[model samples]
Target: MVNTPRLPLLFLDIDGPLIPFGATPQQLPHGYPAYRSRHARPAAEANPLVTRINPAHGPRLMALPCELVWATTWMSDANECVSPWLGLPELPVVDWPETSESSDEDDRSGLHWKTRGLVDRAAGRPFAWVDDEITEADRRWVAAHHSGPALLHRVDARLGLTDGDFDVLGEWLRQRLEAPSSKGVSPASP
Candidate 1:
């Protein structure tokens, strides 16, 4: 039996990518559209913002050739709150390290607080990060530190994940999947 290689990791963020905010009146004249999900539990109804997450994203994200990992401040709340609303099963959540006084330099340097942790979590496996905060500095840091191909695609927080954004992410993942794996670097390598 041929063993297929594991799919790449997709680090997903909740606030910007799923629940959009910070739109100008011009950008969203009536504010962001809200989507209701039949799958949502009664408890989730307490939080009106949960409805802002389009349930369609669950299927769309699932269609991508990657393993989705929740990388958000929401943490396990993503599994408890967001997943049910979006009809997604429990996904692995990234456990972040507490920030230190020294790490404040990373913030000043334009490196996102999540950048280094995401890279470490990926452990050299090809991965894509979807967030509103990704910057060129994060991109450079990931490129330098990660041995595998990485796409630090930034999502517009006001717009959330648009068709154009998905196009870029899908295309990049497709190309990466079709290409031959790098020598001596296993998908499981960390």
Candidate 2:
């Protein structure tokens, strides 16, 4: 019998990455496309923004060689609205910690609130986090604190996850997976 090593994690955000909020006229001259198809887990009263998500992202994300995790403020609701819209299955959701002095300190120091929580969730394993709010502070903090490889990729709120963004992500994740030292939990998706 053999035990394969766990795959790395991909921490995904909702607002900026999947459901873009602040698109300028040039970035999206046609405005965002709406998906008229039915959903498997439709919301009780679905938010209009759910239509903005491109269902194509589901397969693209699933194609990545890592476990997918919801790391957005939407929490479990991401699975309810974003997942079904993208034809994705319910994934593990990261539960944010309650407001605390450490969070306040992190803010004063310019670190993103999600940074620590994500590091904690990664638990010394290789991971990638995609969000609009990421800054150099978050990257520096992760580099200083996290022992394993990490990528703090920032997506444009106006353009959402572009092809270029996917390129960077795919290359980094693939390289990490190919590395002999990479370690994590059971793979969730491809």
Per-residue CA lDDT of model 1 for 25-143, tens digit only, reads 44532332432435445636646667667677888898999999999999988898888877788999999999977488997898899988998998878888898888777877776
> What TM-score would every model get versus the actual structure?
0.84, 0.86
Which lDDT tens digits does candidate 2 get at residues 53-171? 76778889999888999998998888887888777899999999998889878988899999999999998889989898988788888888888888888888877887788888898
Quote the lDDT for 179 in model 1: 77
Name the 10 consecutive residues with the lowest summed lDDT in model 1.
Answer: 181-190
lDDT for position 85 in model 2: 74
Clash tally, candidates in order: 0, 0
Model 1 residue 118 CA deviation (Å) reads 0.6
